[model samples]
Target: MLPVSSELTRSTPVVEYVIGKRQYRSLLEVTSTSTIRGVKKKIEDKIDKPMRYKFYVKILLTWSFRQLTWTGLQENRSLDDYGVRNGDTVRAILTRTSVTRELALDESSPWRKDVSEISDRDTGDWPRRLLHIPTMKSLTWRPGNRYGGKEGPEYEAPEYAALSYTWGKYRDETAEPISIGETEWPVPRIEPTHFTVHDFRRVINRIRRYSGTDFLWLDVACVNQGPDSDEGRLEVGRQAAIFRRAEKTYIWFTTLSEKDWPKSADPDYLQQNIGLFEKILNDPWFGSVWTLQEAYIPAYSYVLDRAGSKLPEISGCGDGTSFKTFTRTCTWLNHYSDTPRVSAARDVVPLLRKSGILAIDSGNPFILYGAAARRRATNKNDRIYGIQQIFGFQLGNTAPNKQTQQYDVNELEIQFTQELLKNYPVGSQMHVFAGSPNFGRGWHANEFSELPDKLPARFIDIFEEILRLDIRRSQNQDQQNRRGLSHLQCLCKFEPRQTESYILGHFSGQMCAFPDLLEAVPESSKVELLVALDYHKDSEVLADLESSVKYLEENTRRYISLYTHDRRRVVSNPGGFAFGKRLKNRHKCRLAVLKLGVHTRSRERSHDVSTFIGLMLMQESGYWRRLGFCLWRVWHPVEDYDKIQWTEEEGYFT
Candidate 1:
């Protein structure tokens, strides 16, 4: 052991910084670790802005999450964390004096707004000089000789802790919230309660009355200066502290062009058709209302990149098709399934299918439509624009309560559909919404068709891309796929219009090749029907279909041996694959399996033979469709066989 080399005992120090050691180089990468005071020292060393200058330069960085430097410089939050390793490069350069002078002359000086640049002439004016410096509360930086990274001991500052603890009342699902003890750390909640009274218009008015005060808690306008992993871990906690602790959460729902929310409409609410109006620009009200006491608004909006809870405490109020909770959205991958966990950055519709909740969406348009409305925020279009659409409100025909509750809108939709699918279950067709994202007022006939023919996820991404389009050339309808998970800014309408011709065409094409799958099913004594949303039940359905197909092949294989693909000619043994006369669409589509029960049969054995056969047909159809087929058959048990009716119903024709 005594013979071990010196390398075994020697260790390197973690830091290189010293109080007086001056290092000179060019600025390579500015990061969140760079404190406000530290940045100033660097800038002072380089450009030599007058040592006595009062104000610091302010740079607004959007599209990138930033952390405030102690010296007032904005730095990227990501680079500050998991970076700054021993081998990472660092550089500091001497700044040009004239460059600093030019910076001092700029009117955009974030530090000393509207004041003359500090000069030799103002040396005697102590009060004016004092006014030039931003108060500690305003500046993001603390005095320092160099940029200090955001990762020292005690990452969760006291103030941030208080805020999250306050807002925790909103997002947590568990009502019985326990305190953060030594062992149990609190998980900061995301988004706000599903929906609150979302009268952004009312909030604007309220804040306007209290403007020009230091108390405003502007959520969209506050600083999220967390710089390290430890800090990020505590982000939501800070959000609760800042927002709930603030006097009011200023919710800026819309940007106003003329004292009102910017005029916009989305009958389809195609994400492509809408543009996000940044409040700072589209609405003049932002500046006025921003001056009020501590206020916060959850501007949950749609943009190229999904915004993190700009701060954890700040909830993003629903915007266009985007709804209340940006943290977790309810989307289904398949129909008859539950919601799935989705990231805020992507669209929810596809995620819905990914989670299996949307498994039946393509077939069960009823659930698909309701799920879509839920994702898109039905309340926005209805309530937010009710004043505009009811009694022809927008066309200058605003009248007395011209409509009943919006609940009737979706309800009337399903009832209207009953004229088509008479067997559909009542609750099976759902329309749940929170806040007036849409459905606040009347809709056109086109909106009604969304039911039964849930709009494709294709349209969702197409429209949300509108925010980033070159408006003049937006006519390029194909830019959709290149975009991220966006939505179609569509309203949930129930009045019928021609179902998208393309979708019907898709199904029709699929039906053309279904006969082969019918040949694959094994029919035992008779085919049993099985329909289960859970995958475990898939085996049961398959088992029954296998038996049915086997029996059919054994019994009817003689008769059904390949004539023209029709029920009339079961050519028991069509010598060879003989050519047939023209194929008929009638017989091809005639074999479709229609569903009578709204929910999947709980006890398949209890269903009457007629229902059982119907279930078998439905189950077979799904497999057939996947194999690219359309035709199927149904058979009843001997007891219920007499009660079965194979005759087509009037409205049941696809």
Candidate 2:
């Protein structure tokens, strides 16, 4: 490939720039003519401390790069707004991990392999947009077991890579033939390994020190810029690959050590150390499970927010793209069903994979054989110890120097592990699994109290199967680029509920659909006449949804039907989140869309055009066909509801 872009090491001394967290220092000088995003990456390496994504991380330009200076940059915007020259100390900083940790780094490890540097020709007018320095020459790059772009006892470090695209090529989505360097250009050897790149400015000082490159690989840095457009152009799959390649990947959990951080610009950066783990999941290998540090777990949910009624929004990892992350580097690598459940069953996609760190999938899919994916890998090593460690992360209980919010995280991990040991490890692989809370005192409400005795044996067997499956692919999982496992099914489950009339779902237990559709509203409103309940305006409407559900439980007897459907969307991750049919053609959604108490039945089925469903009845009186129109009628506590249903229908119907 003819080079559309190139970098050169200046014969003159290289000037260092101190911007935000990153300090920019490179052998090759850059100009404002390059790119705002590219310039940000170069600056990322010099940071002395680890910082989270600035959200909109900025570069305070200073020093004179031939022409560009801090004052000039503040006055104008855009890389092309001005030009940069060699020997210019362009101070720039990105809150993201811009430094590499070289201090006290275990240099004596047997597996250490240093990054090899690029030759003179490798840098000048290089046609290849993807620059890879398989080994860093300047630093005597050696793979190490501790961390950074090095190897461990069980694995060798993958080469460092960085991609440079001249926005011109990528700006066009429908461009002619695909160019890997253009669309998804893979940077040759930059940090010499993905681990060093992520932990660069964060754990240590310079990107070059960790490997040998001034450039940083950041998803936010490559985007067109701005939240809306950046989201559209960002390729999470590629980003996932980059994280997977790293020895340690940083995850952003919504909850921060302090409430001010989110609005403060930098998001939380939880480290995930999956070094040897890289070999376990070879799908576009990132780094080793051990080399991968932090073991960060970002929580992504498909939860809904309640305004007054229900605000349909998926909670945690809101969309599954983040969930589909490479096994070794993902958010909430493991979580229980009740920690916080998704509003939709399909939202399970991101949470279940090896990288997803999930214990369940679509709430209902677990019942089907589809949830058996957990059986593909057996964890011979005792994760129980690790699970206990997570429990140690109790909130407020955290030590003086520790973050307080960590407790919530540990609870989530423990819950997930407990569910897995009880259900997934049985001889039978769980194709679907659901999680809920283990509460105060009532043994009957305890999830396990009701479990059949055989359930434990079944769980053990399933766990064995998962180990065997992982063992078969262990070679790939442990290979240089840990190839991740796929073709695995995800599971999701919910506690059963009693069905109520005028509302969709069974009437015996917790409304199966309630977990997803449940919403609450303000208690103090003139509309209180409608619900006959007073709820606070700010309290989550779910609190009210729960109340209304209880109201229905105590007074109503009728039950409407429920069913499942498929759909897809990508909010943060990738196509990592998708819809799947757990129960095909089963009657569901017969809902209490409108509450006209006392089984207000309407004979006339309204539609833009009717009869679409009429002909099937002629064929046979199947159980489904025997059922009437699908409409949920609820029995409201208000007795007056019975008085208004027979109002004179349209003249013809009357």
Which candidate ranks first by lDDT, i.e. highest? 1
What is the per-residue lDDT of model 1 for residues 1-654, given as tens digits with 9 covering 90 to 100?
001112211111012111111221233234445644555555556544444544233121110111111122343332234233211222222232234324322333223332334321221101110000111121122111111123322211111100111121234544333221121123333333322223322332344343322222222112332322332222212332233222223333232222222222322221322232222222222122111111111212211111112212112323322222211222221121221221221333434322222212122223233332333222333211221111111211111232222334444443334332222222222221111122212111112222211222322322122222211111222112121221122111112233433111011111112222243333333542221111112233323333333334445543222111112322233232211111112233223333221111122345422221121122132222210011122343322343223433212112
User: lDDT (0-100) at residue 55 of candidate 1?
Assistant: 29
Best by TM-score: 1
Off by over 4 Å in 2: 1-654
Model 1: CA > 4 A from native: 1-326, 329-476, 483-510, 513-654
lDDT of 2 by residue, 1-654 (tens): 021124433322233342222112233355545555555455444333434544232221111001112322432254435433322234342333333332232443222333243321222211111212222211111223111222322211222323211121113333332111222233222222222233322322232233344333433233323323322122221232332233222232211122211111011221112222232233221111211111221112111111111112213333232222322122232322113332221233332343323222221111211122222222211122112212121112222223222344334333433333233221112221122222211101111111111122213332222333322222122111112211111121212122231111111111112121212111111111111111122323323332333333233322211110110111111121111121111224221111111111123343111110000000112111101111121223221232222121110000
Q: What is the lDDT of every predicted structure here?
A: 0.24, 0.23
Model 1 misses residue 375 by how many Å? 14
lDDT of 1 at 588: 38
The true-versus-predicted C-alpha distance at residue 459 of model 2, in Å, is 34
Q: How high is the lDDT of residue 481 in model 2?
A: 11
